[model samples]
Target: MQRGLSRSSSLPATSELGDALRACRGAFLGVGLMSCMINLLYLTGSFFMLEVYDRVLPSRSVPTLIGLIILAGGLYIAQGVLDLLRGRILVRIGTSLDEAMSARVFQTVVRLPLQSGGRGEGVLPLRDLDNIRSFLSGAGPSALFDLPWLPLYLAICFAFHAMLGLTALVGAVLLVLLTVLTEFMTRSPARQASGLAAQRSELAIASRRNAEVVVAMGMAGRLTRRWAGANASYLAGNQRTSDVAGGLGAVAKVMRMMLQSAVLGVGAYLVIHQEATAGIIIAGSILSARALAPVDLAIANWKGFVAARQSWHRLNGLLRAMPAPTSPMQLQNPSQKLAVENLSVAPPGEPRVTVSEISFVLQAGQGLGIIGPSGSGKSSLLRALVGVWRPVRGHVRLDAAALDQWSSDDLGRHIGYLPQDVELFAGSIAQNICRFDPEAKSDGVIAAARQAGVHELIVTMRDGYDTEIGEHGGVLSAGQAQRIALARALYGDPFLIVLDEPNSNLDTEGDEALTRAVRVARARGAIVIVVAHRPIGIEGVDMLLVLKDGRMQAFGPKETVLAQVLQRPAAAPIKIVSDGGVSKP
Candidate 1:
């Protein structure tokens, strides 16, 4: 009963594989029909030979025999052509499925919430992608195509002799058992191997990122040692999986030989007893071996299936984990007005909210400067307003509508957000800025770059905005990359702009230019919110909000908050008015 319950609980093992096959079910059906036709032809030819041996040969009807041979040749040629067409169609189907599954996996990875710590760097992503690819490419469809062949082969075996048919049936059952056992035994190690592979991929990425630093510090030897250690661990894990799989395969080999010998021996005894003819027994033996062929192929490729299954689950889990938009509430058209009410922002795996019960608002044409010490939740507050972190206890709004009511795509279109880390892709600069918006013309892109103070730099490039920038804008300076990223945000002319420490990497001239851009945006009736740890050029603007110890310590105009915090004695720590319950003086 426990075993039955366990089997029931396992994700309908057929679903993922079935879905993949059904994606190209037409080609699969064609292959099946052709296989059946081939088998029928073979059976007819076999019976023809049997009749010739029993009657035609004794009668010496050479003309009839020759005609039968010619007919058999024609059938054989027709079967070959059909088989070839089926194989070509099947290959096309497999290729299409591979491309589709790979695309799905890639899309899923990109949509997953960013992971922090060491978890994000390792082999998890690659393993998932490779698993999905391998499944669709071969392991999945191979098993699917075998399903129709199994019963068909069984029927053919049964028609030859009852005893041989019974023996073949038993052999098939044992072969399936062996394959399942092999799959079960190798599954755990394959998971470990996949995990190790993920880790290796992450390490390689990290090592590349730190390559320049290592070389500058003359620590190449040390870095190499660390990399070697990681590789060694990955190799060891892979070998363990291979060892288990190889061991199980050896055992299955022995079992298959024993089972086949037993079937042949039984068939021989039946022939001696005249229970079946020589041709019948011969055909039965061949059919029994053929029946086991699919099982053997399945067993040999079980590792790929296990890997793919793990990947499929990984992708499913990713989609499951994304937060749904707030239910039933509707924000059909978002506006520029941004408000955060009694908001609490918490990072992943954190017990305490970083910013608690904080409330602020940014009206159109209003620019607010958020200033605090490091780790004061200034950036956290910005993230919350942008819907990156949905508040635990309170609501966020845009134009009096709940922020959660808006879908991610709609939210992005309405609000322009630039995180501290400026990431660029390996593509032409214009492509990176416009992203999926193909209608963004060259003039629009150049104008955006000019507004972000990056036009001069872009024009200097050999191909202007068409020039390719390597991964993460490796060819550009920190300030240049930040400016280009800002241009990307500005390309859409979003009504609400949220900038987190935008001036940190800029020189004095660049900082002033960015300040001018913000002023220009404000002039255009856009709301701008800037989160900065230090004094910024945007300091003398409108309102200020200070957060500390997860509570709003002060909220008012910039002068009011700064003056109140500065009134404390020279040696004493600055103290601003807190919400009373959540913080201490």
Candidate 2:
């Protein structure tokens, strides 16, 4: 939900489809030449078979006939071998295309305007990539090969008899039109079904991911209903698409049967009139069938072609929408003297600002605590400070420079942040701590771990610092995970530290230890900001700010706020709650 890399800039328009096909000149020429060779092989084999049928006279030479048979066999084998080689080449092309497209997609995502990133990360492109897979692998190349076959089959028919060939050619054209019409009828419905399926998958993924939360909240029945609804909608869309496509198929079948019947009747009349021979009739039938090959392929792959086109367009759109970053601000010393002037932030997916007109500052070697009730804008304030969500009205500055003016890399290098929920990769304990700076060495990693209060716990593990944690640090206890995340934040010696609910799940001892680490961060000249309703050992902070209903209720030194709390017995319990929530026996 944070303002990710700035999205102020756009990518070039021409970058959408990738470089033009002409730019890949060699690949296009290779594909075209290979297709021609394949068609030539097929035509040669067809003619060779036709010769055998024509020379059925009893006076034919046996040796010459056998030689012709051998020649035909060779052409068949050559065609098959070339096809095998071409298939391998197609695989390479498809893989290259996927890699190239994915690279562009990622680059565009990184470059896209920050506002569009969240919405753009949805399902269509991946589905489209799947479509691209089918196309580049077989469908696209087959369509290319069909281009040559259509003309060749027509030419062969013309050679036998101009009128008969013309009739077949007209039928071929009609078949193409029918195929296209059928595809058009199904295209919208198929796209709708595909979109519904994508949404269902996203729901399923989100549900699976929050399995623990669902179980804890006992929302199993609700989740099941939601999933069922998505699936039902998806199935309904799919059925509609299938029905339309099926109807088109039925129509095409009737047309094909009627056309073939007419062709046979015409051939019979020509033969009786002594205008054509039996062999010519048979050859014409074969040509007609050959001409239908591409038509059939096109009809069969309608869904795939539509999916691929949509995927291409979606990916192109995302890439084109990526935003460019602004120029980096010049910070002479780059120390953290964080300040917020009339800060405001609206929660994601909602229009209302949760924290409005809130302002505070934290200088080097100082710490500030933000305390508030649930939904009282405590977390929103930290998010604003960290540059996650931009304020609707005000501004945030670090060392007198606007947050927007800093480069993303520079901001990341200087500011360390830990969200309420921590995420860790699958790696050794040391690796997770030194995520960005891998060359930090064992000593540097261990020192940071010590500062975060996890060094001793790590040594107790079988692998010591080398212990491998599962996904998102699943192997560690919650407290251990928190400390490890703290170590990650402390790894690069950042200038400012933003901790969101760091002590929410920690026990009393863990809370005290975390507080000590925050103090250590302050000693390192970091401007430390802690957001928590329950302070958990923040008594020694330089300042305390209370937020309620999106406005600052109190802001000043801890003593002054503590005195205000004591004056009102109703609010006086905050100190005890702030001190690690310890209960009296």
Candidate 3:
């Protein structure tokens, strides 16, 4: 609810995600141990095959066969349990990481736009966190962990026969190369796909927000084609990644199968030459296949690995660039004055200052109105005052303390802001007025509603104060939404109430209510600033400022400033209307 923004100090340093990851080293080590046990146990099947052929069959002992079956079953069961435990542990690791970082990630999401103007990435940081968590929890990590055991499997195959060992070693090398190939092929396309997806998401959000405009103007077809173009670009990049991964995965699988067959053939030739026992044939094949399995799985998951890596890099950059805020010492609400000193302003995300070298001071119980031609920086100044846009230079102080000295929550409590565009969240009418405060009082909601002149209108609705205002208050008329927004600005009788074009959408009665609201706010010893589009909107203010082409042209008592600008006598009343015309005396 704090409407003000100031980058008055360096952002606090942050490396929390990295620290959280490093903290998980111990848990990852535990998973490594489980993997070790699981991989060693994988040899159970190969050795059992060896025993069946060379020991049990050769001796023709039924007891030995029964004993071998019992032993292999127990080992297999143990391996399965360890695997299950490892999977559970991995899942918990992902969840733990999410729990540690999601809040901070969301904080960055909210602050990033304010700091960077806007990169149009839109919630991508949250999506990046999700992508990383998914990669960790999925089969990718297991494949990576088991990849180191390939040499162990190869060594066992070597003990069976030299030819079998060579075949397995060659297969391992080939599979590793395929894995590398997959990495190289997919990285660039994955990056492209990610960007295109973000662009597509931005387009969808804009379309939804301006649905009325699009539908009203017969822009539906044009918008659809635009969306389709973006979708096609994203699809192209994503499809390229999938094709490369799938192709490489298929090749890896075929290579592993062929290697197993080749090892078996070598084993047969050795036995025919009396260089090896018949048992080594099947045993070597099984071991050789297991040796390369991890590499194959790695290749299959390379796409996710690349995507997660890119997402990881993006998050790190964003986090470091816009670190979490360090809350300042809490301060009491300003009840005395609002002071502006040498204030210079610009729109967020733009570099050039739109309003320059302006200074003003208003004691409590004073109301000031700013009048200007379009593009003269009236709105820009309003944005800076409410902390929506930080000033390039100078400071806005309340109670002689600079705005940035107040923490967002503390500042929000004392400040009320109504932008030219009235944005109301989906909720009951009372909730919107109260800014969704959890402990909002029923009486306070009504008080604000009445102050904005929307109270009588509210009682006529089906649910009165409880009436649902649907999405973005779509259920209300433009004037109704604007009035409700004013009620919101007046909620809790904020110490500094700022209204930008408050009467732009209001009828005559709504305008009277707004003028009264300004009067009441001043009566309560509050400082009120109104940016008026017409002279009538400034009627409640005793002082006025005129802006022209981003410069402060005049500032003084309301009638005096008006008369000076109009070249009329001080006693002559000059009224500036919305359409660049003044009323004659």
Q: Which segments of model 1 are wrong by more than 4 Å? A: 1-9, 12-35, 38-71, 74-107, 114-130, 147-163, 166-170, 217-223, 247-276, 323-336, 534-536, 570-585
> Best candidate per TM-score, number?
3
Q: Given candidate 3, what's the lDDT at residue 110?
A: 84
2 versus 3: better TM-score goes to: 3
Score residue 489 of candidate 2 by CA lDDT. 81
- Between candidates 1 and 2, which one is better according to lDDT? 2
C-alpha RMSD by candidate, in order: 4.7, 6.8, 6.2
Candidate with better TM-score, 1 vs 3: 3
User: What TM-score should be assigned to candidate 2?
Assistant: 0.84
The global Cα lDDT (0 to 1) of model 2 is 0.71
Least lDDT summed over 10 consecutive residues: which range in candidate 1?
1-10
Candidate 2 error regions (>4 Å):
1-13, 20-25, 55-59, 103-124, 216-218, 246-269, 324-333, 436-440, 564-585
Cα RMSD for candidate 3? Answer: 6.2
Q: What is the model-wide C-alpha lDDT for candidate 3?
A: 0.86
Question: lDDT tens string, model 2, 1-585?
Answer: 000001111224355345532244566567667777877776764565466656643347687678888887898898788777777766666676666666555545443323542554554555566566566677645664565578778888788787668878877878889877976787689779878888898889888879889989999889999999999999999998877776766666666666666656666778899897766666677666666666766666665665566665666566555533555655655675887898888865468889988766778988888777788988878877887677788899888887787777678778889888888888888898887465677777887888878888889999998899988788898888988888888877788888888886678767777788888888889877787757564744677887778888777777676566658577433332232332321
Error of 1 at 210 (Å): 3.6
Question: Per TM-score, what order, best first?
Answer: 3, 2, 1
Whole-model lDDT values for every prediction: 0.69, 0.71, 0.86
